[model samples]
Target chain A: MTDQATADLWPGERTEAARRLLLAAVESFARRGYHATTTRDIATGAGMSPAALYIHYPSKAALLSEISRTGHRATLDLVEGAEAASGEPVEQMRRLVEEFTAWHARGHTVGRIVNNELHALPEDAFAEVAELRIRIEDTVRRIIEKGVARGEFEVPDSRTAARAVTSLGIDVARWYTDRSTESPEELGRRYGVLVLRMLGSAAA
Target chain B: MTDQATADLWPGERTEAARRLLLAAVESFARRGYHATTTRDIATGAGMSPAALYIHYPSKAALLSEISRTGHRATLDLVEGAEAASGEPVEQMRRLVEEFTAWHARGHTVGRIVNNELHALPEDAFAEVAELRIRIEDTVRRIIEKGVARGEFEVPDSRTAARAVTSLGIDVARWYTDRSTESPEELGRRYGVLVLRMLGSAAA
Candidate 1:
């Protein structure tokens, strides 16, 4: 909407330059927030002209689209890859919670932007992001279903339980920070215990 | 910073007008998010001039600060009022979960905005808001500790159990909507059952 939208600012940059631009945008977006972060701010943060941002992406929306897409993909891979953790369904669930929560706590910018600002994305992009989320959610549902069948867990409404687990992990993106006393590993382990109890299983 | 810094905005003429402005701000902040929402957007949504909005509030920050303070106060009141809902500690805990979840579902805009944007406020405002939150959290913690002491329930750690209970209820604001098949009351009751089970008690 502004003159020469951020999308058109840069074409392609040096690999390091693009990486810096991405990191700068991440910090700015996390610090001030998405809609408030201008291409100029991100470009300046990367020590480039606003016009240079276009070398890597087409628009500010493009920047957000990429971050969200990438973050969701990473999250989905963790859940789907839980299937490959080489453990019982319950242990797989534990590993899933640990990996998921830690990623969110460390990947604050991208994860929070993805989870909190879904309503901000343009239509086609939102659909892509939502589909990725559904896959991750379905992963939780399947894990719970398997646990129930194996008699490792007892719970009512696996779908709701799945929702609870996913929601708990997602909220870490909203609130958890390194400034807190609890380390990511410790916090995730504690959350895993509560999550397992919620599912009516043995201690995590 | 704007000339609209008058006390008239607090709660004067045409109470519905102020109410409408407040509600519209909530929607704008939730839909577009706190950082993205501007006075112009909110004023436009309420069919008022930007100057008219000033007559109602000093600045955009004031609007958000007021909303957050009121929302936190409302939450504190809810928790304190629900402290003695039934004869038994377990029943009281169930009522707390049911009420809190239902409150989050019904008041998603306020809860979401307060939870997500509290950091945007200045230090004094932030401290005030944090105090209210700690109070509510302690109330939940005390309730669980008391329940354990009374032998109505058992928990691994009363503090951890409190966090799980609050997190489950708080998550309702992020996910539960009227669009879902389960009504707020239904979700509240179902979540209450899980909370009881996690506390080592039978479902109420």
Candidate 2:
């Protein structure tokens, strides 16, 4: 229940019941979307009555907001961790794309909800989620800026390049499936090079 | 009440009432998403009673299906039209990216519903919409294949490269705003160059 990978993917602690609820919410939200998914649906999916959901979460919006905040923080942490892992900008970009793309492909259920369902969150929740998003953007931008500063990468605009690179992974959640011909690791490898090339990396 | 651009953006001829309902549906779906938006909301948005909506479209799902089909067809036409406008593979890629990106930015409301709200579509309706999506993929893949053949582009995998290039524009619908400093044309121009860079075009 507490594997290293699962522990790393989700940022905060949760009880077994709370974990079940969040997992149910991810499936329902990814399947039916935030606006359409009800707490009853999430509760039933988790094998509990509708009333049981409110004991752990205030509303359906609370469930979605928690998921959004957790996913965003995890994403930001992945990239920021990559930035500190090495001083080489090229390696940093490669690891960043690989981990990010794989996360989106393998955890598409969470990825889909995190990226596509933002508008459904309440205003305050959205702001909290958005702050993490901006930090993710800034972290990617800093990686590009570092490469540019070292004359290692050639991008027209670091900010736009960062956006495109981020979009590359986010869109993977939209199309990737269990039956996809390319495995998550394979996609991560291909995208790693493709993104480096987009950065105008001569090495790519 | 129909403008030339609106007529061009939406395929087929629609009655004024039908057009009103569709336009209203786009606004509602783009704002609240399909599952959250009711037929009454669409009807009210169009200044018609709920019953009046049924006269034009059979159900809420029907309105969404129409919008999804129209938008997917419109997108396919834009890309195919670009392919025919030039014989040069590089030029073909450039125009394809420019027009496709601009359409997503300028026509984002429709684009958002078409891409994001597919699950709300019934199975048969989703199948029809998906066929157009596959064709859009093929069209982009063909552009890359032609460029690779003509020595105008360098890509590791044409299919994956097509997905990335297409994703570059599709994600624009998710983030573009009236407050965005870059206009549709500007985003299109920047994206065209970035896509060319992904293709490894010497010019880029």
Query: Highest TM-score, which number?
Result: 2
* CAPRI tier for the interface of model 1: medium
TM-score for all models, in order of appearance: 0.89, 0.94
**DockQ of each model against the real complex?**
0.51, 0.65
Looking at model 1, what is the TM-score of chain A?
Answer: 0.88
Candidate 2 to native Cα RMSD, angstroms: 2.7
Tens-digit lDDT string for candidate 2 (B11-128): 4578889988988888788778788899999999999999999999999999888888888888899999999999988898899999999888887667777888887898889999
TM-score of candidate 2 to 2 decimals: 0.94
Instruction: Give the interface RMSD of each candidate.
Output: 1.6, 1.1
Best by DockQ: 2
**For all candidates listed, what's the TM-score of chain B alone?**
0.88, 0.94
**Model 1 deviation from the true structure expressed as Cα RMSD, one decimal place:** 6.2
